[model samples]
Target: MEKFPRERIRNFCIIAHVDHGKTTLSDRLLQMTGTVAENKMKEQILDSMDLERERGITIKAHPVTMIYYFPEEKEHYQLNLIDTPGHVDFSYEVSRSLSACEGALLVIDATQGIQAQTVSNAFLAEKHRLVLIPVINKIDLPTANLTLVKKQLEDSLAIPADEAIATSAKEGIGIDQIFKAIIQKIPPPPSFPDQILRALIFDSVYDPYKGVILYVRMFSGKVKKGDKILLLSSNKTYEVKEVGVFCPKMVPEEALYEGNSGYIIANIKNTAEIKIGDTLTWETGGTTTALPGFQEISPMVFSGIYPLNSSEFEKLKNAIQKLQINDPAITISPESSVALGSGFRCGFLGLLHMEIVQQRLSREYGVDIITTYPSVIYKVSLRSGKTIEVDNPAKLPDPSYIDHIAEPYVKSYLIVPSENIGEVMQLISEKRGSCESTESLGHDKVIMHCYFPLNEILVDFNDKLKSITHGYGSMDYTPDEYRISDLVKLDILVNGEPIEALSCIVHSSKAESRGRSIIHKLKERIPRHLFKIALQAAVGGKILAREDIGAIGKNVTAKCYGGDITRKRKLLEKQKEGKKRMKTFGKVDIPQDAFLEILKTDTKQS
Candidate 1:
């Protein structure tokens, strides 16, 4: 493949808030460049995952190279656009994409103006020292307030309003302006061709025939076929088998050069060895000074994942390993439960990430799995002066052996209309959070910076915020320090045996109410057996709540015609004794629907 000059190659990405039409604008760019034929075009062309297309969201960063013919300049240029996800849950994806590019197109929904992620992504781009071009999209909508959006751009983001490009990506309007702006405003990729090979592994996928195929953005040098490359993170070496660029599809190139965005295929059978944020340098005489901004990601939420059928345990494990190749953000370790059998206790960035993994397992791998209740990591200070992190409630140490338990906190940034500030404040207070400060954004929108427990906002907090603000509010959060709290483990018991999968850590004040809600839902779902069943919720040795299910009695005296009263009494006494024996040995089968209901209690009732 003939290489384009580094000065004419621009590597940039699109960053925006959720539902802001970033993907649509990407489609427009691809169309305008004639990268995809008009007949072959489709919505969200880069969203290769069926799950992403069905959810109408991008879960991965997609990089593609397009050739633009400049009529005025009378030359062709390479435009490598990395399309990224806008959801805050996938901010890691956005940040990693930003690292591989020199410029970002900050797309904003004109109807909604500046959102939480809009500001959040803008800050992230600035942190990377990249040039940002603010693009106001959805201009053709009747509800789009271009004036208000431009004002927010100036007030919230401090970007000049006149510099913003107004576009309707859906109608293909103003695409030429955006196209021209890329060449005129955004700078080209920086090249260091004389340096040793240093390609950032922004993403990777598992290909059965080719082993692990890596998607990398070249930083300092070049790598060709058969060149020995080492993974700086793992200190392992492999020979490069192939090199190519994404023309929306893999087109074999002579070599991936400096400042180029492309893939490197190698004999990497073990996908785990390739870390996403790691740098790839020449195996020999490699520089120790690795690329900046690459750090290990720690998951914020943890949950137990078990195959619904125990026979699929190995299959589930294999599926998880393959999924991990795509989503390295998730952490997993072997775990077992008496009730659910062998499984993995996996950690995730958030609830949405957890849900996506579960869905992908079912969709992609055909694995039927059951996911237990989700949890956040807790800091436990032992009485012996040793500190341990507990991400699962079942693994929590006995209360007698603890000095104090501290829960993780988050500094949340919320943006909402001024009129909804009172209700939003009340909602935060309900979750045991305190407001730190508030600043006015533009004219009517207010940004509230507050602090709350990580567990408090783990589930339905954002959903509630959207509901309270009539779908106009947005939120972004960062992990804060852990603080001491009166937290306790809430255990659910059937008869006398505790169910580990149903247990969770809860604040002391909410323990009793939470226990009652679980028992109430259990009673409605549980069926009467031959023996009396007792549903109980306990904290330590104290029973906080209970529900009873009476046994299914048989009519013992119906067949005895004109039987004496003592005879009936004797029969009833015998039945009571049998029930007593059965109660001692009976096992209650908790249906899958019941577990789902208990999770609903924890997620919604909280």
Candidate 2:
């Protein structure tokens, strides 16, 4: 296939919610543009990750360059395709991908219309100054309503409704129109200076056999094989081993220059030497200024990740370090967990990001992890006029030790069909969420943006939301600010010792019920050991709930049966002979399962 001319080169990303036909549209575009043979095209062609394919959700941002031939002018245009993730947790990855594009194909499900994620994604694109081309996808469905979807986009986003393209990517209907719209509506990337070799590193991945592959967008200068470049973010230099442009199937070696797009690979000993948002310049005298947005991402979601087997701590650390080299968003630090043993305190952007990290650890690294309850970092002030940050529930200061505690909250946007608005409101209200405003998206759709306590929705919120909406409503939320609320730290004592696994925080109102449930569940799951176990939930020295393990008489009395009858009798006599081994209903050792059961209890009862 012949490469298109430079003037027609367009770099754009496809943004949409999960199952909004973003990938299907991409396949159609590639097919119509003659970039791939019709027979070779498959579902989610751009979601090259095995996990992404299995889950049918785009996680990593995938980039592909295609050639679209225009019949009207006998022209072949170069199209750099960027496929971005749809989950809110991966929004950081989406933001990085948006920076590399000049425009975006905003996809909307015709029947479903604008979703919560769709609005947030479009806002991100607009923030980055990317031209938005609204496309109503999945037009082949019987329930697809293009007119309604168009009006929603126009009224809500202030875009032209008539300009929207109705496309059925599965059947390849109106795909050509979308492609034509891309060339007409999405302008070519603005030309940059060719004097310097400055490229923005959007993302990087490690290929064991191929070393590290860096995804970059060059703003100026040219890159070729054997060129020595310096990574501005890391301050480490590398000798470029190979330069190649993406061809969908294989990365063919090609010379990419200014106003063009592609990725480059340089063999280096340490993959950590490269980072996202870094600038690549010639080692000797290529460029002096570094690219912007080089700050490392701070993790908002925190959790204790430990190996199920204590001996795997070293292996777990190495696996996490290696994963971080590719995933810069994941931050790791040494953590000593009382219940889970030695582990690492890892940070992530959100829930989905956390899930992806844990999944990758188990699947990619072949490590068994014992993950603790996910928690948000809390800022606490002490009476001594000092402040401390706490992530572990066990580290929570005693009531006397803490002056005040602040928790993080978020401004959440929820998009639901008009019929489900009532249900949506009720669910949010229960979470201490207050409605900020409500606006209609055309007729049958309403967008509700509200302020909600982050902790309220941190657990099982996604599942509960889907169930309430009948899988129709979608949500997107961003951390807003820390707010002071009436919060109490609840502790669970096992045999008079507080185990980290049973520590939790509950609103003062629900403390009794939540604490009771946690104690009951822990008692049921924890196996009986030699000693009786005492499960107690307390708040500020006040016991709220209690449960106990049954004791054995014969097993306890065996110690007195043998051993110099007189000495054994003398030893037992001090405790009234067999009375020391008498059957006590509340005596049994707490097993590992006891701690794990605490996580499964209903700790959010109100």
Candidate 3:
């Protein structure tokens, strides 16, 4: 194997929709570059995370560097590959991955043409000023249509689409051409002064065995093993204990200099010490240029997370704090949830991020948790003349004390086959989404862009869209401005006690129907307690929806059963003890499933 000169290094990421062969193409790239043995290759190998491989999705951004030799000119090039999440919910993670790349490999499913996510990600690449190298993948699929995709790329992106290569990444067909296209389209690393040692920390992860592995793309100077470095983002300094380039597996090299991309392991005791988007420079600061667009990430989705066992609450908090070090997009704060007890209010980019956090908690920390329904930030103006930000439902101001509210909106894109176009439009309209424009991409595929309230789809909208389209339509969205619309905040009460945290605002017309359905669902999932429970949904202190869950009967004929009636009574006592564990939402006894099941509901009137 040969290493390309540092000057030939090209740091880029492959962006695409799920199952669009982003991972497969990444594996083929590694093979073409001789980073991984052909026979030893696995599917989605770059998705090294156990959770990601099991889910058949790339949940985290994975970094790898390979040496590819263009056979035509016999020129060797070093490629730094960042494989990013394709799901729309992880778009923020994708943005962070994009920051590390000067170019992008936009993968389009040849059979599917351009899906919603692919076009959205390509636009994101353009926003980052990344040189886009379009690659049509899965050519071997029976429905593959390379010619139309070429035309779509040309018409939609207006990029030169003359020489689009078709590939079956799984079969390694046209893999070399894809590599050649990358080298031809993506520019070589820029020259920087050797006077200063500086690099950008694009991503970081905690490894119990390796400590903190920071993914870095070097811009100037040279970094050697055992060098003391300063993390500009946190002003923390550490000695680099190990350094290596990612070659499917870490391949330790002698050194990395300007224009090379690799990972460095500092002998830091805590993984939480490393922050993504941090800059690495010499401890003895000499010169520096602030990297562009290194803003701190703010989570967009918020929820309450409590341990299934109250005693583990503190442990969950500590675990979250540790995880937040590597996961900048996740935010945690102390919160008292009526339905979840005293837990942490966690914020994430989207639902996928929330799921990743929950999975990590159980798998990595061995902690089981009861999570509240995910919510987005709500801007509230109190009557006291102070503006407040609420991420948890419990923090919502009382309807009597509230002045006005605003919720975030998102610009969404829905791509569907022409046959399902009507169904897609109908679904969007039902979600209060306004069509922005529609474009026909030849064939039967159409791209529809709409402006939708974030609150409308934050729950259940994704599943409903998939269900309606019969899995043919896919969508991606980016946060837009907060919009003030006619809305009413509905509060949930259990046994005449208001659970402020379970409150949510819905458009007035849908409030009654939604409130009734949600309350009914909650009742079905929640177990009966010793006392009868009343579930009420209130707007402006007036109840719009109500339900009652009958209490468990205490009296059982002790002598009616077997000889061990004492044991049976003891078992009933245990059942009563379990009832005490059920969380209360106002007067309702909510079982564990009530929180998660709410996210899967669809209000399409089907």
Which model scores highest in TM-score?
1
- Runs in model 3 deviating more than 4 A are 1-4, 270-273, 318-322, 522-534, 548-606
Q: Model 3: how far is 557 from its true place, Å? A: 18
lDDT of 1 by residue, 1-606 (tens): 568888888999999988899999999899889999999999999999998899889998999999999888998989999999988778888888988999999999999999988988999999999999999999999999999999888887899999999999999988888878888888887756467888899988888899898999988777899999999889899999999998798899889987889999989987789888899999897767778886567899999999988899999999999899778888999999887899999999987889899999998999998888789999999999999999999989999999999999998889999999999999999898999999898789998989999898888899899999999999988788999999999999999799898899999998998898888888889888998889999999999999998888799888778857898899889988888887787778877778766665554685
Ranking by TM-score: 1, 2, 3
Q: Estimate each model's TM-score.
A: 0.96, 0.91, 0.87
lDDT (10s digit) by residue, model 3, range 66-165: 7777778877788888899999877777888887788898998998788889889988999889998888888898989888889999877787777567
CA lDDT scores, all candidates in order:
0.89, 0.79, 0.79
C-alpha positional error of residue 203 in candidate 1 after TM-score superposition, expressed in Å: 0.9
66: Cα error in model 3, Å: 1.6
Candidate 1: lDDT of 299? Answer: 93
494-532, model 2: which lDDT tens digit per residue?
Answer: 766776766766567767887888888887787765445
- State, as a TM-score between 0 and 1, how close model 1 is to the true structure: 0.96
Give, for candidate 1, the lowest lDDT window spanning 10 residues: 597-606
- List candidate 1 segments past 4 Å from native: 600-603
